[model samples]
Target chain A: MSEDKREMFDEQDDGKVKESRRDFLKKIGVAAAATAAVPAATAKAVSIAETLQSHFELMSDEQKQKAIARLEKRYSEQFGKQTTVANTPAPDGVLFGYALNISKCIGCRRCVEACVRENNQSRDPKIQWIRVLRMNRGNLTFDPKHLNEGKPSSDPLGNYGIQSGGHADKAVGISGEAEHYYNPEQVPEENAFYFPVQCQQCEDPACTRACPVRATYRDPNGIVVIDYNWCIGCRMCQLACPYWARRFNWSEPVLPNEDMNPKTHYLGNRPRMVGVMEKCTFCLQRVRDGRYPACVEACPVGARKFGNLLDPESEVRKVLATKQVFRFKEDFNTEPKFFYYMD
Target chain B: MAEEQMVSVGRRKGQDEVIADKRVFLKRAAAALGVVAAAGLTGTAVIQSARKVGGTNARARCAEEDVRQQQIMVGKQLLLMTEGEKQQMLDRILSSHSRKVS
Candidate 1:
């Protein structure tokens, strides 16, 4: 070959060699970076597994056991105690129901305190599942004549036509305006009656129906429950609930290790994370073990009663048979298992 | 003049060959990257499905009879008494209390 041609071929070969070296260096750089990230990726594997885990109801027996074990370990380490998360299914031939005698309640809020202690509710944000509302004794009335008495008078001379100083009529039964934070030195105030509200455990729950993800559902024992992990934090169930029973965790739940109840149920009063909806499970953790709910046991007056509605001899059945009972918002036809009675 | 023209043509041909080689390299690199990404995603999806437990229908099991009875009780309002009956019962209790006080 001519000398110039040989020089041209050598220059092209040099360029090719330089380009191959640059490509090799780029590959080495990527491999080193990936190697450096291995430890962090490994550390996050457990959390990743948890996030990808299936819904609790969809798990088989073995998967459920594995999931429960994982939760127990995590909770035990978190709370500094031996936490046991029970997955007790609904017992056969039993339908749970609740009854409360409005006359017997004193508006003391003992049940509210007891529920917080038992449920491991967030303390810093102060979430309570039970809300006790104070209402006047004759607040509920069917008479239509008294309705117009509360309206403002159109007359210029107020006293001669209608009273100006008098307040509006108390809402016809339980309503949003009822005093939820009344403190008058002591409870059972004169002419005032207490109405404690919690999850009604409805047979046809609108909350369950509104749940797009099917995370909350009614169990065989007539209790509504939520799968915390499966919940998408859409707040649809909270909006659907008429009783204002559901509580949402806006911030990270602050549960002191000392105050944490080590015993928990998968669907009941387990410690929940931020951005999840929680509500009363009728103390299913205790009830499924054949024990009275913490609220029922804590009440000074025996106003709260819980039992299987199927059994003829149960306390709830007896109350249903004889008492003058009424379900809240009966017009909605949600078929709540909870009944309020007058003695 | 002809030799100068030939030299210029040769340099242009060399530049074209280099550009074509770079294009082929880029195409092969892109295809390799795409294959790797597809494999990673498919593997992740397979692992997730394998880890998940099956049978969503089993969780929906509930006692139908108890639910029926509850519906019946609610429909009949068996636990509730009429306003007149409640008043009468309260009056009877008060009268009994008054008699005992006397």
Candidate 2:
């Protein structure tokens, strides 16, 4: 062959060799994937369908039904009981609001216990959505004797009535020294009052805004909900939450089969997996069903109140209109639906 | 010319055999794929039916129990209240808040 002909033949040979090598590698990759999938398919621990499921919000009506059906089946098998994962949407012309009578609260943690049981929260690791702070009464009051104490003697500002005693300059309502783990012989401890804190279900929720995946969001009824499956476990929502409302599952949730609440909502109290974040959804499962939350019913003194804010006669609206109601961290401009009132 | 003809015939025979082998492999692969697809469909149908039966029964039981629980809670609340409180409580319970809009 001529010089040009020989070069062309050599190039053609190289091209064929490269194509064969590429095809060989592609076949090996396919075989390896199939082999790996066989074990996953047979084990039945995590279904392939579940891993490939789309985001809850992006799914169509038919897709949602199928997803719910899949979840219901999986939960039933795993918990050894028939579990209903309700996909109840928010009711129209209704905005859910909560009001708690702090004065009536006797420091009993029955609400906390009821919440854990009703929500199917992890028992062993003990993830509590509600934290009851026992604040000192002294911190809430200003001693008249100290009215003259903080005054600067012979100052140019001329007695601005700056006080020091009895947490004069400190944040008065909720003190930083409030005890969360107080286990007294009996509740309603003298000189102390209880303040139960949970998800405020804010109008402008910082946690939802901080979520990178849009996993957490505020529903139409003003309740903030998290799609646990879509959560990347980045803990951005946890850090962004001003009320410290969110809880993260660090390890595999240790819930006893008997203790698991079978009545669950898809976004609410359904059993969660490890690494996802969960918090008080205001008992959306029960509330959407026209029933009160477990915490609301469990309160012995009837301190906690739940009702539609849009309705003028609802208990929450009544509390707002009649009582001295305040939101925790109101300065944050979060516009929380939860109100704390003094009866 | 005779030897060249013999070699050409041998090469054609080899090519024919190779084509036949490829056809056999393709037939086997297609049969395996069909079997897998059928099994998957049947298995899925069986699992879905089982889930439906169990879910329906459990849902009925839960609904009945839930209604009973709500009545009990309402009754208890009424019993603990005075006459005026009972009137107010009843009014509130019968309000839009207790009604399921969805």
Candidate 3:
């Protein structure tokens, strides 16, 4: 062996020395422990820092920047996909609003499936943010007779009727007056009209008021958001929302690598752990980047409209003016930003 | 008076020049570190983050797919929606919100 290579034991390199099996074993044990200790220590430190992080509102500009970088790195490793958790503040002079042309909804449920993929909502038990209620014309209640007796509401829809629509009312506490929700093979049921309901992102959010920890609150841009870490998952906000907008994460979010939307925002679709409340941020992840919400883009009929409520020329604002806009449960006086319109 | 005060114009030491002076070296190091930290916080780039996107993951490789393959997009001309769904949309337009049982 060469002079340097011969120092495998290195006993003679430092002067007269010899190797002992005990010493060698002891050294190896320490090396092994150190190797394990590094990652363990790093992980513990990260969790400690996460616990110390201030709320988005409370963070200073410098602190918020650091927080965004930290969250982006953390999510990148966890999902094995590149993620950018931007802390893009709600744009000034912009309050996002949504208006869905109910006359155009076909009850295709494309929006529901799109949301499942876009928002990282659980697939197994199925948490749907947008609930499309297939109601009989002139009635807000679900009636199964549209499909139960194998009779359609009218015309070609009745002729082609299959089965669906029993999921929305009960979840939102509309079941008392509405009994039957049938999913039917085809929709619009001739006599039926569909309107999707999600987080109204109320101008006066009852969910925000109901939050015991004040984890859920409306940001300056008029988007109601949840601070995942601060949320105790007491579910006070869930019960408080007349729209049933908030959802509890009963378990750690299981996101498939290929299905994960790499583009994420800190206040938006970045995945959550087992026991936090999540709700629609109107696709803050995408919208802040000047892109449309997943459901808005996915609608084939071009029914779902979204834009800056502050911009007079925005599509949503135009729809609000030109169409007959209606708010669900407006009697509750929550002042929901979400509007349903028929043109 | 503050604006009128004379400011000294001095030659900036090169990266190599300040090596012998501990305080100057330390101050220079701190300034450089601050710039690096700023770049990192911006997530613009500071020697390319270890957890950057387009790392060796298969999900990173999936970006090679065409834009149409993306799940979320606007005004998609080719409908992934079914024929029946499209027909219903057309029916709504033809009927003009008054699809009468009559």
Candidate 4:
């Protein structure tokens, strides 16, 4: 609206002015369209590349960065919220460990619900990482005859008296099987115990070895994880795991767009498309950030303990040192980092 | 004697579908003795086993290094406990479940 600017515009050659302005407008429109299309177009392109992408180990640093950024943007669009997807590697000199005080767990299932929410597991089919097993408190022992009769506790700690270091070890007390899959109105069942089981994150993981493609593997931080995009959903890991920790996504996970956890780890809790195997990663997204696992935060009774096993002063190292700790199936030689213990 | 006892245990199972109530109590007492004998008794062996919790050895198999480690562990666990939990832990370590009997 300045007089000099208006005069300059008016003085321009009418024919040339129309031509130049039209060309400028055309350039500006094309530039804006390309800028807008890049992310949407790139997002679509990234999805295709992601399926065909090399194993994370084989990708270069630059390729990994681009892939992670695109994934964050794409997930943000899909979930309609700000999303953060990153590949946070485990710090050196830290080997993670977890312990559960079986007697302290009240079978509240708060941890189970917390896991479902944190991991973006299916809502309708209800994929859960942690399973709290209600077992009768009686004389239980790992009798060889019982092992011959069936698999040694497909229910993991459900029949915990036999899991070692309890009154059940001597075969001296009451005799009965666990009243498993027990869903009661009120928990801390009379004369009963609760044993919550999840991925042991084995030192020598059976689930990883069972993977034909090495899709499921243990991280340097001692967490057994599945690369969801690489998984073929063969369910071999499920069969190999003594703890029965692996879960298969039968249908695309039913998490609502709004409900999905926007904070995700590349090998941890990102929302998975159907046909992949998933198990607990000890809330890798949170733990790598120096926070407790979601389930551990939710547990009201302080039953769960997690810390760096390599650190001499950490809770997990001290617990294993002073307490009687044992694996679910020691004979299987999985060498699980998870332990059931009592002080 | 160990072989005979095992054979007798097998025989008892073969003979009866249900162990008699008196037999169950007798078996528990004998098993309790076995636990005491098997603990490789150190100083705390007799008292702990006598409590019918012979499977646990309070000072069993711990070396000097393990003792240090356990001490450090106790310090760490104490930090995690609430005041109430700390009291319960104190109670457990200070005495057996004698209060439960009363």
DockQ of each: 0.05, 0.03, 0.01, 0.00
In order, what lDDT does every prediction score? 0.71, 0.71, 0.62, 0.66
lDDT, ranked from best to worst: 1, 2, 4, 3
Residue A313 error, candidate 3, Å: 2.1
User: Which residue pairs in candidate 2 collide?
Assistant: none
Q: Give the per-residue lDDT of model 3 (tens digit) for A235-338.
A: 88877886666666654455777787877777888777656888888888888878899999899999999987767799976876566566666556676778
lDDT of 2 by residue, A87-151 (tens): 98888877888989887999789999999999999874667888887765533322233333443
Tens-place lDDT per residue, model 3, B1-102, is 343222211212231244336446545655565554454444433213432332333232222211112211111111122345334432432233223346
Every candidate's fraction of true contacts kept comes to 0.05, 0.00, 0.00, 0.00
Off by over 4 Å in 1: A1-46, A142-176, B1-102
Candidate 4: segments with Cα more than 4 A from true spot:
A1-46, A142-180, B1-102
The local lDDT score (0 to 100) that residue A115 gets in candidate 3 is 88
Across residues A189-280, which tens digit of lDDT does each residue of candidate 1 receive?
Answer: 88677778889988778999999999999877878999998898898998788776787776556789999999999999889986789999
In model 2, the number of clashes is 0
Off-target runs (Cα >4 Å) in candidate 2 are A1-45, A141-174, B1-102
Q: Name the lDDT value of residue A101 in candidate 3.
A: 75
Superposed model 3: Cα runs more than 4 Å off: A1-46, A141-183, B1-102
What are the per-model C-alpha RMSD values against the true structure? 13.5, 15.0, 19.8, 34.5
Superposed Cα deviation of residue A17, candidate 1 (Å)? 16
Predictions ranked by DockQ, top down?
A: 1, 2, 3, 4
Relative to the unseen true structure, what is the C-alpha lDDT of residue B56 in candidate 1, on a scale of 0 to 100? 21
What is the lDDT, from 0 to 100, of the residue B34 in candidate 4? 48
